[model samples]
Target: MSNPASATGTAAKAGLTMGALGVVFGDIGTSPLYALRECLQALPADERSASILGALSLVFWALLFEVTFKYLGFVMRADNRGEGGIFALLALSHGEHQRPRKGGSWLIILILFGAALLYGDGVITPAISVLGAAEGLESFNPNLAQYVPLIACVILGGLFLVQYKGTKAIGRIFGPAMVVWFLVLGSLGLWHIVETPAVLAAVNPVHGFRLLAEHPTNAAAILGAVVLVITGAEALYADMGHFGRKYIARAWYFGAFPGLVLNYFGQGAWALSHPGDPTSPFFALVPEGPARLVLTGLSIVAAIIASQAMISGTFSLTRQAIQLGYFPRLQVNYTNPDQSGQIYLPLVNGALALGSIWTVITFKSSNNLAAAYGIAVTGTMVVTTIAFYSVMRRRWRWPLLGAAALAAVFLLFDGALFYSNLHKLVHGGWFPVLVALGMLAIMHTWKKGKEEIFRRIYANEITEDELCNVAASDRIVRVRGTAVFMAGLARGTPLVLLHHVKANKVLHETVVLLSVVTEEVPAVPDAERVEVREIGQGLGVWRVVARYGYMESPDVTALMERVRDTGVPVKLTETTYYFNREMIITGGDTRLWHWQKRLYSLLSRNARPVRDYYRLPPMQIIEVGLPIQL
Candidate 1:
């Protein structure tokens, strides 16, 4: 007889593994629709069979080395409190510093750029995946080719529209659908592979080397297409926090990897048999019949799932950025009450929808969209490799030589893929780059402007003794009820609290100065979340520091409840929340350029208000305006 707890654990792991298949593997699993076809299309027609085998060989090893070894084996281990992503890696690399360490600005810039590139990936992934699947109609019927873009746009619109419902609801349907999808992928490929058993020889790495050696000039272009095989690899790490490393790895090895391998080789076998047939090997694998239509429909569904994964990842990344102070605050909605990770951002969704739909309408074909795809993926991959090195050296405290040797190996592959995609810059690759640059600018400005504001506000800070003296002063009127002043700085009096006392000449009978700090981790345990300090001998002036992980949003009401548990006389109903609303003036003296200052001001103006972001009650909230010039 087995233990009941063991059985329950096993069942839960299996459920998570299934969910991982739907969310984590969707992008890479759908690559069979276009990855092999793109590789073959990039090669010479005269040497069709050899090129097919070589491309297959390259794709095979790329997945084995890049995804299986580098990411899942190494980078996932660098997770920050069980959360993984570029930002998580950034936090780990910086050690325990809430702020960047000395000379860490460069690393922050690099990581921010990596994050910006992901937004680029988010835009292109949806457009290309849906378009690639929709293009299957061309093989189904030549006349239907013209309707592909329209169909893709409609699918994309619906996908974004349903985001408000969140991923937890959609993942339920997506999980089983993907299981069937992968089964079909493997079975179809296996059928073709048996017909041409020789295709299995491509498993040898020599075939991959030979392809590149023979066509040295075309090697870059060939690798550029091959990079598509592992484009979704980063999602594995980015979404690791949602699904554990064990479940994601289990899903990859058992489900995604085998299906993808068999399909690519099957496509290779099909390409070899039908030499000079200019049809897409993916769609051509099925004969012209109702079966082809069924496969096409499955392809579209799979494509939508792929797009959904990217969009969801973008939402998670944006939340992390905003909480970490790299980006301005945006309205974040928790889509699932049970899951904090499942969130939706309206502005982010709207922007992605417009960008994705515009991409579909403009490119009109997956082939054109593919030109814009690899650059962003490879660029982010390279950044991840570099950032991983920092984690190994600093966080893991690995030996210098050991870290260098391992990072160099990964960087070699990353550099080759990134350099190969450079030729695509003029051929629609500029789309992602343009998007990344815009995002980089906004992030840099927000970070810089925030720092300047913090410095200016705390320039002439008051000590606890000074605040306590003010509390004891006879000139000050003690009003009834409690007042909660939100402090930006964890130490000393907040400028807003000081200003309120000076301007209003009145203090609450019980004053609570609350400071919320975002730590360099994913989630803080509730026990370690709040710290309280009492000021003066008997005065009711208190300082509370509430610590939250970058993954969480602060709730003043909940925090106060926690404070009340600590024997403080704080009541949520009787408490009035006070916030500092900064009015950004761009023309003041600062290191920022005229353009950046203006941009920073614009972002600040549009940022979500502190009251809404912190979930403070509207009736008891008071906003104190403070003018800050940049």
Candidate 2:
């Protein structure tokens, strides 16, 4: 008889594996729409057959080494309490309690740059995926060629438009649809492979080596295009937390890997047979009939699904960044209550929509967009490799020799791909670099600006003892009801609290100094969520620190209830919240450039109010304006 607990766990793992196929593999699964075509286009006209085989061999080996071996084998193990991504990796490597040792700051910059590249990936993935899929219309009816961009733009717009509604309803279908998608991919490739059995010879590494040895100049360009095959590899690592490492690995081994290899080989086989027609080898595999139309429809569906995955990923990444203090707080709306991971960020969604549409218009076709794709993906791959090596040494405590040996192998592949993609810098590759640089600047400025502001504010901060002395003396009067002062510093009395007593001439009989800290992990246990203590000076003063994980929404009202439940009985209606409203006066002594000062001021003014984010009652909230120059 099957044990009930074991059966339940088995069912849960199976479900997660299926879900992973839909979200994690979407980008790579849809790559066949253009990756093979782009690779073949970069090759010389003379050695068509050998080139196709060589490219196929490269694609196979890339997946084997990069995605299968490096990410699935090594990177996934460095999870931060079941969460994975570059930021999670950064947090793990730095150690939650310890200050980063020696050159850790530089490591952080590398991780930030890597994360910035994903935004480029986010913008370009939809444009290229949808356009590549839409371009297949030409195979069915040549008249549809002119409408590809328009069709792709509309599909992309629709994809972004529906993001707010959340994917929960249709998310169930995504797993099954992707399952069917992979099966069809495998079946199509198997059919073609049976017909052209000779194409199997491409599996040999010698073919790939020979092509490079024969044409070193063209090889780099071909390598640039070949990187497309591994474009979505990072997503595999990024999305691991949504599905556990075991489940994602199960999905990759059982589903995505087989489908991708078979389909790629089948496309290569078809390319070899029809060397004259350099049109999309993916679509050409199907006869120009209803079957072709069906394939095109499937490709578009797969592309839209892939686009949705990236858009959702951007939302998650932005939320993490905001929690980590790298970005300004934007409105993060959770769409599904049952699933904590399901979130919608309006500003991120809007920006991504505009960027994707602009890309579709600027490139005009997937073929043109292909040049812009690999740079961001390869750059991110290199950064991921470096960060992973750091994690292996610092977090995992692997020996120096072992870590260095592994790093050498991973960097060898990552470095080659990165250099190959660099040739594209002049040809549309600058788009991602520009995007990454701009993002990096904003992130660094925001972080530095916040730090400088904090430094300035805390320079003359009053101590808890000083506040108690004031409370004890006749200098300040003690009023009736409870007052909560929101504080940034963990130890010092908040400026707003001190100013309130000075200006208002009185303070509530009960004063609570509340501070919420965002931790490095995804979720903090409720047992460790709130820490309360009495800072006694006979003023009924309490120092409260509420800790939240990066993934949590801080609910101060709920925290108040918890405080009340723990013997500090207080009525909600009697409590008043005090907050500091900072007005930045720039152009003083600042490390930031003049324009950055202006930008930081702009961001600070427009940031969401602390009271609102903490969900405090608006009517009961009092704001104290504090002017500071930086």
Candidate 3:
């Protein structure tokens, strides 16, 4: 018999795989509701059967190559400490090319844009998914079509409202619900497949190629619509941390992929039998009565689940961005204290809520929103493929030919999707592009402004020897207890510390100059997390450099413990934290333009206090205001 402990471990892994199914697969799983119908809309009425088969073939191969082979086979292996996404990929790629190189700026730009593009995705996915599902109500009664947008808006609002609770409470049922959703998707498709077994022939690659060759003009349009099937492709890699690579891969291969394939082929079979029917082929698979109603309800639930995943993903992305210093510090709440990833950002949530609600109200229908959708997803996919290529070459030490070959195949498909989606720009596709551009501006400004501010702040930084000399001199009096001075640079004394010593004319008996550095990876190993150095010849003046990965939230109390573990014992109760609060006056900036300075100043002024973000006790923390023009 198997060991009881081993059995429990196996069972737990299986459970995580199930949970991965619910959150990760919801977006792609629900694509069957509209992806096929939208693709068929691009086909000529005269050759409906051939077009349906070809489109189905393309969808099949796209999933096979993009999701199955490209992601699971290759890109998943480039994960950064269990976390995967554009940012994680950037960190992985940067591991080898640590120094700035010729193409480094372009690579960084692409990665930042790829991340910014997700906001566009966050807006479109919910509007389209929920709208697509609610549109199913139209199948039962055509008069219900007018209510679809309103219903979708209500659902979207409700989904955003609950994000504050995090996914902990409702996440339990996500796996089961999505499992049933996929089963129904497959069963409905299978039910139709039995009636029309010829749909299976679409699995062959020839039909897709034939469509591309025969109707090159219309193929672009069809491909644009077909790309919808893989819209949620990034979530597989994005949520790799929440569920391990193995579990996500298993969930996709065993649960999501098969179900999606069956459903798409099943829709194609149904469309072949009933050509020129304007009704949605997905709901049409179920008989027009109560069964369609049930499927519609399931579709709505699945869509909401998809929206939830995207919303939660935005929260995670915002936290990572802030931790990586690409964005200003925002208010982050951890709903589940035990789970670090289960965070909620109110600013991100409000922005997404407004954007999504505006999308629903503006588009007013899934079909309209569909026009705006694919660009961000396709752009992100292209960036991901490129980032993966960089990793294959630099980190994995793959031969140039091998890396180029891998990149060429993936980019060919990704480029085609992105090129085709460009047709949407005039017809509402501008929304995501605009959102991405706006986000890029904000991120670029914040990063540039922060760099300039740091440059100015560190220009007068005193070295360890200088600080040691001052500490040993009789010019300064030593007080009781430790004063933990937070600094931007690890070695130099913080400006705030200088200000404190100059004004108060006294220093703490035990001075801990704490510097927290965010490294490029997801999580730093505990052994490398803290580095303590004696600066004043055992005068109790020590420099502590605490390194954190981008995925981590720094807890000063914990950092103190680590410092204490290194023989520098300190009590948090007695120690006071010092921070420099920069009063940014934007008129006299060194590099930034007037508008950029104003924007950066607005962001700086509104950013959460350094003490609060670091989780220091409000009472014990003292902020020294230093006015600076930038």
Candidate 4:
């Protein structure tokens, strides 16, 4: 008899793989709508057959090597506690050191830029995917082409509007919807392939090589267009922490990969048979009837699903950035109580919606937006490879020669792809670059300002002995109940506590210095969450350090319960919480430029209040304003 446990395992894996299809593969899976069309459009029309076969061959190997071998076979192994992303890779490469090693600053800068580039990708993916799908209406009725952008914008708006409902509710239908979407993709492609078996020969690498060898001038352009096929590859790795490597790989191999391959080949075959046809190969694959309209509707739904994945990924990335101190703290809502990863950021959602809609209106068509898409994806890939190399050498302790050889091979592909897209800078590629640079400046400024504040706060240290003496002093009156002071540093007494005592000349009978620390990992176990220590004998003063993963949001109320469990008298409702409210003043001497100082100050002012962010009892909280110069 088969083991019941084994059957259960298979069932759970199957469920996760189905979920991965909806969320992880949506971006790449939807590429067949536009990738092949754009690739063929970029090549010389004189040699149509050679170009079609070459483009198909190139796309096949690109997905196999880059998405399959590079990400799944290798990069996924570098996950930090089962979390994978540029940030996770950065943490792994840095190892146990809290600070970057010598010459590691460049790696940090590179990774930050890559993370910022993802915001650009987040904006473009939705615009292009929705527009690509909406363009299908043109094949049904030529006059509908003029209204494509409007239809796309409406779909994007509706998608963003429903984001407040959270991913769990929205995700229920994603798996089933994408399953149907991929099935249609495979069916259409297979139908065409049966009619023209000759297109299967495009699977050979020789055709891809011959295209480049024969057409030297258009080589870079050809590669640039071809990069579209693998634009969603990074999403596979970035979303790995959500579903895991095994399930995501299962989704790709069994569901997404075969469908994508067959569909792409079918598009190529259809293109060969109908030369000089101006209609979209994707929409043209189906007969001109209600069946085509159904396909179009399905494409729009798939595009929405693709956009949802990117939006969700952006929320996760923002949370990670804030926890890691690279960005200002924003209000994050946990949509699902069971899943910490399901989050909604109102500000981030609004910004992305606006950016995506603007892109749709500006580009006007999927083909136009395609010009702006590849650079951000390729730039991020290069950064990931470089960061992965550092992880191999430093964290995994691989031999230098082995790591270098492997990274060089990956770089040869990534670097070529990035270089090929460089000329696109003039052709709307500047959009993502501009967006990335703006984000980089904001992130760099926030981080620098925080470091400056950290250094300034610790410059005049208050030791435990000093705090104890103040507590025991005859001039200071000891009041009833508990006082919890929020601390920026794990070891130092919060400046707010010192200010409160100095201003009022009184102390609470029970004092708790609570510092919430975000570790580089994804999630910390409850048992290892909090560390508590008594400050002095019989003084009723304690130091508590609560550890959390970058993927987690700290709940002060929940933390207090853990503190009470530690035998410290921490009442959830009765305790009064104190927080430092910094009044930032610009124009002081600092490493940051004049403009950055102003921007940092602005971001600081707009950041969610500490009590609000932590969801503390607002009525019992007190804010002590402390003015600081940048």
Please list the C-alpha lDDT of all candidates, in the order they appear.
Answer: 0.89, 0.86, 0.87, 0.90
Is 1 or 3 the stronger prediction by lDDT? 1
Ten contiguous residues minimizing lDDT sum, candidate 4: 1-10
Off by over 4 Å in 4: 1-8, 96-104
Off by over 4 Å in 2: 1-9, 100-104
lDDT tens digits, residues 1-630, model 4?
Answer: 111123256667777889889999999989988999889988898887668898899999999999899999999988887788988997898865656543128888889999999999999999999999999998898899999999999999999999998988778999999999999999999999999989999999999999999998898889999999998899888888778888889899999999999999999989889878878899989999898898999999999999999999999999999998899989999888888788999999999999999999999999999987899999999999999999998888899999999999999999999999998999999999999999888887888889888888889989889988988899999988899999999876789999999899999888999999988888888889999999989988999999989988999898889889889976666799999998999878877788988998999999999998888988999999988898
* TM-score: model 3 vs. ground truth: 0.96
Q: Per-residue lDDT tens digits of candidate 1, residues 254-359? A: 9999999999989999988988888989998899989999999999999999999999889989988888888999999998888787889999999999999999
lDDT, candidate 3, 370-484, per-residue tens: 7777999999999999999988888889999989998999999899999999999988999999999998888878888888888898887788788888888898999888899
Name the lDDT value of residue 418 in candidate 3: 96
| Model 4 lDDT at residue 517 | 93
Q: Sort every candidate by TM-score, greatest first.
A: 4, 1, 2, 3
RMSD of 4: 2.5
lDDT of 4 at 201: 94
List the lowest-lDDT window of 10 residues for candidate 1.
1-10
lDDT of 2 by residue, 162-206 (tens): 888998886888888899999988888888999998888888988
Residue 338 accuracy (lDDT) in model 1: 80
